[model samples]
Structures are given as C-alpha cells and as structure tokens.
Target: MRQSACINTLIRRRDNASEPKITDSISPKEASPTLSRLGFLVALGFLRLTSVLPLRLLHWIGGGLGWLFAVIPNRSAATTRRNIAACFPALSSAEQESLARQSLKGMVCTGLEMGKAWILPIEGTLAQVTEVEGLAALQAAAKAGEGVILLAPHLGNWEIFGYFVCEGIASNFMYQPPKNPQMDALLRGVRAKSGIQLAPTNRKGVAILLGALQKGELVGVLPDQVPTDEGGVYADFFGESAFTMTLTSRLAQRGTPRVFCGFAQRLPKGKGFKVIVHEADAGIYDKDLGASAAAINRSVERCVRLAPEQYQWEYKRFRRQPDDSEFY
Candidate 1:
C-alpha cells in the first residue's frame, strides 16, 4: 500500500461555493424493444441468476473459464501474450506464459464479478469491501472544498472501484457505451441506481468533469485508456511507446482538484476486495504533456506491479503504437 502527501496547498487556493453545484444530470436510458430480443433477455436472466451465487463459487467457475481461455486458441490469450511480452521483455518465456495464463484467469474473474456489481443491492456490494486504504486524501479534498479526480486504471475490478467511490463521494464519471445497445442500457440502469452521474467519453463528458471540478465535486476517469489521436499523445509506457489519454493531464493543469489513483484488489479465495488509493505522482502535473502522460503511466504501472495478473492484459493497450506498427 502506497500513499502521497496531502495536497493542502492546492486545496487552499480554491475560492468557490462551499459545495459543488452540479447542474448536469444523466437520465438512465429506458428499456427499449432491443432489450426484448432473445439474446439480450437470455443473457440478462443468466447474469441475474449468477448474481446470487457466493463469491467463492463464482470465482471457482471463473477459474475453469480461465483454463479454457488459456488452452483454447483464442484472440484474448494471443493478445495477452503479445502485450505481456512487449511490456516485460526481461521475463523468461516460461514466466511470460505463466503470467499470460494467470491474466486470462483474472479476466474471467472480472467478468463473473460484474454480476455481483450490477445486480446486488448497494449495501451488499459495499459490504464486500473488507478494507480501505488512503481514504484521507479524499477526506482532505472534501474538507478544503476542492474537487477530486479519481484515476482508476484497468486493474483489479474497476467496476467495483467505481461503485465504491460513488457510494462515499459525490462523483461524476465519463463512460463509453458498449457496442450492444441492450448491454449499454443495462449498464446505465445499474450504475445510475447508485446516483452517480455518467457522461459519454467525449467532449461533452470532459465539459461535465470540468464543471464538477469547478464546483468542488469529485470526477472519476480511467487514466490508462487510449484516447483518440486528437486527445492523446505518444508516451513511454513500460519502455514502449503507448498512445495514452491526455484528459487526466489536461485536468491536472487546472490545479484545483486533488488527484488520486485507486483500485479494488480482488482478495484470494474470494475473501473480499480491498480498496487502495494513492496520490498521483507530481510529474503528472508538469507543463510538458509527454512527461505528464508518462508520469500517469508510471503511476498505473506501480499499481499493476502489486498484482500483475489482475491487470487486463487481454486489452490491446499497445495497439496504436507511435510508428503505426501492428503489435497485436
């Protein structure tokens, strides 16, 4: 568990309302004809049934699925291998294979956990958090009437982490809709029930985040994502050039909100999750955009190091390389 000093100096500069006055609201998308489709209905029912199972059972099932992923000739396993090999070249072939297998298993576990996240009662979901670390930064930001930017990377169970923040803090988050309209609606309905505002992952979302920060509200962002070409810059990630999102850095330039990186650690044997929060490295606030982006990557890297297998290696994070090389 790592922590950074309080950002009291930045918080002191705020001269605004005693509390954030957010005007924007996101209404959950209602059930439409699309959800009545057979596939969507079946999937919804299956997830609902899965939600009631004990965490340990769900994890056990996930482990079997992970075994299948590692043994089967699948795109996910292939991509995981490629990303892990590129990021950790020093690892021996045997080590890389082991990591890739474990990563696939973690991915399966994350999928199984989604049922608990979306279908369980808010109280029941929050109860799953056995411990929390570095919450004082959130408290200090609130006390000083300054906003907070919670940077939750794609490590451990990010969905759980988002819900945890919404339960405790007044937060707004940027979301990307899933390709399936039915699934997208389901997510919106489930997440909106917690009263956390969500905006599309676009310019409008950025504006909402800015407004939230200006009024001293908490804003959440997944800083490890790859932004569109116009919104990102090339930066060194794990000694390789990765196109990283700049929105976090741009918001950091605002110099008001206290930025923190957080994640939900999946405890072994399904004991529960532990929420860990840490202050962003100072370099993320640097005027140099590239340096700031690299610093952001470094912060995420540190979190990943805690549990490499829990990170989402299946994602094509290094897909858009600086030289346009097809790494995946």
Candidate 2:
C-alpha cells in the first residue's frame, strides 16, 4: 500500500483536479427514442412525489407490482425464472419457482426504492442504513492512505450503497449514461449531490479512475457487467461460462489498492438496509487475466449469497457463452 513519490505528487494534483461534468458527456446529436422532454419531466415529477412516502409503504407497493410481474407474462419474470433455475439446479422445481417469484418482488422493490435513493436528501437516505458490517477494512485502507477498488454487485439498493460509501471517502463511480439526455441529466444531478465523481464507460473515464486510484482514493465498479469482447473474458459464474468484465482485475493489478466486494442488503418489511463489505478473493490479483476475471465473479457470488432473493435475476447475466451459443 506504500505510494511512490509520483503517486504522492498526483495526490496533491487531485485536490485541484476538476471532475468531468455529466452534461459535457452527453451528445446532442443522439436522440432519445422513447422519452421526450415533457415525458421525462412527468416521470421526474412522479418520482419526486413518491420520494416523500415512507419506505415501508414503498415496499408494500413494490410487493404488489412484483406479484403482477410473477403472474403476468413478461420478459423480466421469464428471465428471472431462467436465471434462478440455471444457477440453482440443486433446488426442486417448486423451490426454484418460489425463489424466482420472490426475486421478482425484490427487483420491483429496488425500482420503487430508487425514488428515495435519488430524490431524497443524502442524509435522509443514509439514515436508512440501520447497520454496517466490515467497515473496518475500508476505514483501515483509507487510514493507511491506500486506494480501494470497491466491487459492488447488482444487489439490494446499490444506489443507496453508492451514496453511503462515498460519504466517508473521496470516491468515484463509473456509470453508463442513459440514452435519454434528460434522464441522464437528472440522474447525474442527484448523484453528484453527494460529492461522488462520475466517470463514463470510455477510455477517458478509465484514465479518470486510474488517476483517482493513484491519489489513494476509492473508485466503485459494478463487477457483474457484461463488457465488450475485448474488455472481458469468459469466466465461471454460477458454474457457467459467462462473459465478465476484467476492469476490476486490471485496476487491482495496477497498484496495491485493496479490493473489496460489498452491497447494501435490504431488510424485510422495509425495515432498512445493511451495508456489508468483505475483502475480495486472493485470486483477484492473479497475473492471468482469465483467472482474475473468475475471481471477480467469485466475489460477486459471495455478496449475492448473503441475500439470494435480492440479487438482480432479471438481467441476462449468462447471455454470452464461451462457445457462442445462445444462453437466454
């Protein structure tokens, strides 16, 4: 974790570095196919109205929405069922179906809760983190002036987790901007309110993240994302060869930054959330890129196991396979 003289100089420069603005990243030439300015405003207004509701009530509404997803024919429900079945083959058919239904419900709850995560005041939203586990690791890293690569999977309420983590450290999160300019602007404005810097998913963004790490700051990455062929390698995820991002592995190898995987687990009854953190598997730092990617998936699996139903099953995580076969 020791820093070189050059790194120290970069640390000093970071204090005065101007972060990339989200507005500047948007391309005016690109048009949003689904949403207009008026439509975006209406959606924003609805989200703002829902932001004031109690968390418990939001969960209740989400449960109803989830039930609808389970009973109705939809792509999300199908995907959830397929993922659960493939990942948990040991489970009986009945058990897998039950888990899929619950997962659908949890996914709906995640969507409804985003209003609180994005529209509510930062302090108010963080107040819902009733407990935190394994924070000492992150604190120790920060205290020793070491950069950290935090791998946050698509678990319960990741938006809330991002805000909570950035509150205590100079953190940067890499995000893919929405196609809709208006929506992207709104999301950027809310996320930046907590002082977390945003980096796009491009070369410049990668450089920004590298700079942050050199400065001994934390950078967050969604480890489960499916990267382009050149950016990732096929790795074992849930016993299947899934295309996984190697960005975390590459970043971890660059410096002595401690790599950790974490998530905010949603408690039952909309009680609150629990922030959990754990050091990543040792293989994450392997010199072999494929081995490193496998370790990244292993880390994500560990976090998902903490709350299986809360994991995002609707995503086609195993769509790309080693043999170029159709998975979903």
Candidate 3:
C-alpha cells in the first residue's frame, strides 16, 4: 500500500526546539479581504457578549435557537434527520425527530459554550468540569513514555475536552483554519493559553503530531470528520459505510503509544461538562488499513453513544460514499 501519497509538506525542526514556528502559516497580509475582516470582528464581538452570560442562560438561548432551526426547513435539520434515521433504524419516527431536535439543541449549546473556552480564564474553564473519568490510563501512558493518541469525537463540547486534556500534558493537535484570517488568529491565541502546539490541518501539522508522539507527548484528533479523497477509506460507522480518516491508523503504526477515546459530556441544564476517556479498540492497531480505520470509527461511535444527542449529527458525514453515491 502507498504511504502518505496525500500528505504534501515536509517536517523540519531546529536542534533542541520545544515548539515549532506557527506565525508564518497565515499572516494578516494574506487575509485582507474586506468581507472576511468584517465577519471576523462581528463574530469576536458576539463571542465576547455571550461569555458574560451564565452557562444556564446561554443554554436556554441555545435551546430556543435550536427549536427555530428544527421548525424551519433547512439543510442542517434535514441532514440531521437523515443521519438519525440511517443510524438508528430501530427508533420510531417520533423518536428520530425528537433525537434530531435534541441534537440541534446540543450543537447550538456547543457554539455558545465556545465563548467560555475562548474568553474565560483557564482556571475559570477548568472549574466547570465536574469530573475527569479516565485519568489513570493517560497517567500510566505518560509514565511509560510511550505517548498517547486521544481520539476525541464530535460529541458534546469538544473544545472543553481539548482544554482539559492539554492543560497538564504537553500535547499537539491539527486544526482546520477558519476562512477569515482574524478568526483563525483569535482561535490560535485562545488555544495557545494552555501552552499546547496547534498545527494547521496539513502535511506539516501531521508531521508535528508524529514528532510529539515520538517525544511521549499527547496527540489529539477529531476522528469523526470526513477526510478528502485519498486521505480516507470507507468504513462501517453505525452500520453505514462512512469515509473514515486513515491518519489515526498511520500514526499508530509508528510506535507503541496508547490510544484512547474521549469526550466531554454536557451536564443537564448546563451544569458543566464531564470528561470521559476509554481505551480504543484493539483493531485500531491491526495491520490492515481498512480494519484499522473501521476500528477508529467504532471507537468514535462508543464515545458518541455516551451522549448521542450531543453528537454533531448536522455534519455531512456520509457525503462521500464508496460507490460514488450522494448521501447529503
């Protein structure tokens, strides 16, 4: 099998460097579009306003907005309905609709919760986490100096989960940059507060992640997103054939790092979040690429099952089918 035919950049580093240079990736000169600048400012202002509100109030507003989303005829609601129907065939129509509504509500809450993550102090954010369920495994992995790959799915508030994990551990993760340069800068600034390395989703980013793993540091990936052609393979997710990223499997082949699945469970009425981590399926380490990808999907499914309603069902996960059929 061909290895990394899609990864495009080379990884480079100076001797004895702890962090890679990131400021050159996207500079202000490259993102001077007038419209994008306006949108970025508006977005930042909105986030600041939301950050001052209580968690309960934000969730209440999110619930109201979610109802509006479900009531209106839009692509997001339609996609959520189709995904729920395909994944949970056992549910009645009423049940599916209810689940779809709940999922939409959860997504809205997730957006508002980003205010707390981006604007609030690190201690303020950590204070909201009610508990961390699976710490012993991670601590053990760190002590062994074998590194760890944290497969964080799109369940609940992923930003909260990321912040919690990287707070204490020297971690690295790849993130797709936003279209607007200002927004991307703001995101990078907020996430940098924890002193973790953030790489843009590209060849350079993948290389950084690999380097971190080699150094016995934590690496995180959102294993649920649909990768581009040549970057993923079709895998059975919730009984449906979904395109799954092979990066997780490719990285696992490099070393004996422990792989764990994790997510932050949103508490009722925005009480806070609960972080849960568990061991990944053994099949993730299998030699077969397809099998490894499927195993990664199964790991994600297990995490989403912890709080199904919070999964980002609105995403077009099944958009690229194996037989070239359009799902969304």
Candidate 4:
C-alpha cells in the first residue's frame, strides 16, 4: 500500500512536470487516452467469463463481433475504404471490401491479445513467426557489428515485431509516453520484462538510440507515425502529403547498413499469425526528400499488403497537411 502511494506520487509529479520537445510537442494535457486501461478492463472481463466457459468459445464470440464491425459503412470506415481504393486501384471493389473486413477482425484479435502480451512469454508470443523469409540478410547485417535498424511499421503486429527482436536479437526499441502514466508504467514493465530496453520517443531517446547503434546493437522503430511540427517534413504518402518521419531515411543514409523490414501477419480461421521479414526495395533513398518519402510510402505499402488485416487503418493518418512551403 505504501509503495503504491509512493509510485502514485511520482507519477503525479512527472505528469505535472513533463516539458515539450522540439520533435513532438505533445504535452501531458494533450496526450491521447490510453487504450491499455480499457484493454485491461476488457481482459479482466474476458478472464472472468472464460473461467466458466471455454476460452476458444469466447474468442469466437469476439471474432464474430469483429467480423460484424468489418461490414459497417460509417464515415471513418468509408474514408479508409476510399483510401485503400485509391492506393491499390488494382484491387476490385469486392477485394477492397474483403481486405477492410479482414483488417477489422485483425484489430479485434489484436485488442484481445493486449493483456496476453503483458503476461505471455517471449517463446509463446513468438510462435507466430512462421517464416523468416530473408533472415540471411538480417543476420548478415547483425554480424557486421555496425548496428542495424529494423523498421517495424504499423502494417502488421507491431507489438510482436519488437518482442521478436528482443528475444531473437536482444535489441532495443523506442516508444513514446502513454497519456495515462499508470497505463504507461504497466506496459513499460511488460516491455522491459520481455528483454527489450524501452527508450522515450523524445530527445533523450534519440541519444540512447545513437548510443545503442554505436555499441553495435539494433534499434527498432515505427517510422510511419506522424512526426511533430518541427521533427518531420511533409511528404506525399499514398498521394496525400502527410508529415512523414525523416528519421528512417536519415539513419539508413548515414550508413546504417542492412536496414530491413518485417511484420506479423494475422492469419485466417482464428489461427495464429505469420511473420514476414523482407528487404525493402532499394529505391527508398533516391537523392531527393520527396523521392525518399515516396520510397518510404511504397515500402510501407508492400509490408501492409502481406497482412492487410493487422494494419490499423482507423488512425487519423492524414490528419494534418503542410502549408504551401513544406518542412521535413
């Protein structure tokens, strides 16, 4: 009880004292609501119900509800549908719709697995790494002793991607602060326990990442996330000028040899997932910022295709636009 009080006091102090940074000006007041709190509650309820009935049965129930949501034509869903349609014009309407539904089901399953990640062992969690397609390239990079960067985008099981590295490569990952300090602490505890050292997504975190690279350790990052006003440049992503994070291109350009990408694809029939690691097409760094950003978007799209269901399309990805003059 006393320990809890001390921790709470520390959290309150930190919350009130957090300062803004040049890259991301997210203040304590502007932090998004933590999904972990609600996830925990949902997990708690799931456990209680599962204790009486079969776990598989409840999962099916969640899956069914997930599928139902897949078909709903709300505004946001429509926007996502339209975005996918424009991006992958090759796909027919029925195929795009199918992908959308599959993506929603993947999100629901991902939601249910949140609590599991908190408690599951790296061995069990990584059972989903079905195939390491081009692991030789990653292994080659790791052996070079110059520190490699593993770009894990939101396209698939991003959470699982970090764990795979920590368990298999003993690498470090960067994550931002959660809005709710309590929830952040809970997840930080889980991530640390899983063997991946977690760094804040602020200036200090950048230093830590650099130091890790210097020590010949891999640094995993999700570059598709929106960059802060000052930290990123507005680049065309999927035909929309989204503020793209220039960090990925910069690192790879600065001689982080052996940059590779990977994601955990959600599988069918309520089964497990598949992990796909591939070499990003070489053109993502073609001289100009605009070209490099386009390359980054293309690379993201390729990975997103492997497991479209796990991609979180619900995010306001294209929320902000750059003024006539752009800054990256």
Clashes of each: 0, 0, 0, 3
Please report how far candidate 3 places residue 183 from its true position, in Å.
0.8
User: Model 3, clash count?
Assistant: 0
Query: What is the RMSD, in Å, between candidate 2 and the native fold over all Cα?
Result: 10.2
**lDDT tens digits by residue: candidate 4, 237-279:** 6667777877766666665555677776655554555667787
Checking candidate 1 for backbone clashes, the offending pairs are: none
lDDT of 3 by residue, 1-328 (tens): 0001001001011111132243245554543454355555666676788777888998999899889989999888999999999999999999999999999888788887777877888887777788789968886887677889988888888887888877778888887765446766877887788776887678998899899999999888889888888889899999999999999999998988899998889898768889999999999999888999999999999888778999989889999887888887
Q: What is the C-alpha local distance difference test score of candidate 1?
A: 0.77
Candidate 1 lDDT, 114-169, residue by residue in tens: 76777788877787788899877776886676988888988888877878866756
lDDT of 2 by residue, 126-207 (tens): 9879989997888789667799998888888888887887687888888776544676787788877888888988999999
Q: After superposition, how far is residue 119 of candidate 2 from its true place, in Å?
A: 0.6
Off by over 4 Å in 1: 1-36
Q: Which ten residues in a row have the lowest lDDT in candidate 4?
A: 1-10
TM-score for candidate 2: 0.88
Cα distance off (Å), candidate 1, residue 99: 1.0
TM-score of 3: 0.89
lDDT of 2: 0.81
Error of 4 at 274 (Å): 1.7
Q: Provide the global lDDT of candidate 4 against the true structure.
A: 0.62
TM-score of each: 0.87, 0.88, 0.89, 0.76
